[model samples]
Target: MSMSRTWPVWARTMVSRGIYSRPRTSQERLRRAVEGKTVLITGASQGIGRATASRLAAAGAQVVLTARNESNLRELEEEIRAAGGEAAAYPVDLSQPELIDEMVDKVLAKHAKVDILVNNAGHSIRRSIDLCYDRYHDFHRMTAVNYLGPVKLTLRLLPVMRAAGAGKIVNVSTFAIRTPPFPRWGGYHASKAAFDVWLRAIGPEIRADGVRICSVYMGMVDTAMTAHTPSLHRLPTLTVADAAGIVCDGAAGNRRALGPWWCAPLEAGSVFVGRPLDAVFSRLYQRSSDTDAARRAIL
Candidate 1:
């Protein structure tokens, strides 16, 4: 059985109510929102993006899958098509800005307009400041994939969405950014937070143009992205399917923000008790041991 399935009833209940509750959207609702729409999903080769693509396509959307893994994207494309869904795969590394532009152009050339854009691609790293002293590339790569890439893609597609007078942009952001900052996650947090703030800042400006934006402040999930962090494995996490469902909810629902029930409280705490929270997090960080990956990298 899965780790989530093995959890005690109370433990599961707390997770569902507090940390990361999956949003349940009816198939009929999803179909009504995205049917016949051209939706583009980044990082669609695996994990949440992959699952989201499958779900959206099943709802009658023309799904466009993009990621660095060409083989995986092609395989998913075939799988979607075999299931009687419309899907097209375009493999492009999000870290490459030029490639993103080219891919967007190609997609526009084919589909003319993308009615929904899911900015789901991301790169995550957890390393202490001391460990990163000699690894500036870590910050660079994180910003490249998590921040700049999404911004570029959004800019390219926003004009078309505005011109069409109707569109939705779903940003699959992390819940960590809304809470007190955690140690050893500076680079990752900063990069993701950049895009989060960017999207929210422009949301009002574009709302009048018939473009809507939803930011899903997602919690930990069981995916290749988190597979390397063994400590995270012990925590309650959403399955890829659960995460996908939440993304679909953001796609179909009118909510501006979707996240755990505890998110707002945590955000308030971060603002009111920033210093105390920092001290507590510092103590926790001091007690924690480095991961095997961190040790390997330092060596």
Candidate 2:
């Protein structure tokens, strides 16, 4: 019998029905896997990072929270401490390159070594290359934060993790990278795809040194990041807690990549029929935008 069946009927039913989508591992096993480990999470001031910090902290991990918002980070730290969980906050603005080296130095000086690293920080832009023709800085800014920032941080931490003999790195990535190329996301897609490819390239090299890399190709989640999109407002999406749980599962398990179950078939389809899919999506988005513009003109 599958291990999932060993759970009570209600729990198994929930899993089968896709309501409670946690990994089949028991709670105690999850706790034991994370207990006493030092985990550094980026973008922890809000959204997925905040939720992840809370979950891992409750699992007995020593959580180091890093983000740009000092006040929010401190509030999260206080809440975690009140709940009897260990946590620390380090405010960082990832878009600044010079500060990254200094920040890494400061973090190493304090923690010495981090058992797990979660790269949850990112930036997104949704303007077409045509619209961005004069906005070169937008491309540079997003690329710096989404691609270069994580690279610098990971490169610095690699030595510490190698010395410790065992380490895990979890990258929160977007599912759009695998989808048929959509319009108006050149900057966002390119930056995120660069980091994803870079990590995959170094993954084999790091594995021999007792470091594991896991990339979570995430779908739409109900977070502040997606809050302003009218189309996404009413759409069903993963909760922050659910997204964090998936990240924790990657850290605790041997899986190299985790994503929504349906993502696999869609990704496979894109590989074989990408050209047609791209054409279709292009028409769909362009048509909607044109209709909206026409309606505005009529009004």
Task: Give the runs in model 2 whose Cα sits over 4 Å from its true position.
Answer: 1-26, 290-299
- TM-score, every prediction: 0.95, 0.87
Model 1 clash pairs are none
Q: Write the per-residue lDDT of candidate 1 for residues 168-192, one digit (tens) a residue.
A: 9999999999888789888999999
Q: Tell me model 2's lDDT, rounded to 2 decimals.
A: 0.80
- Number of clashes in model 2? 0
TM-score of 1: 0.95
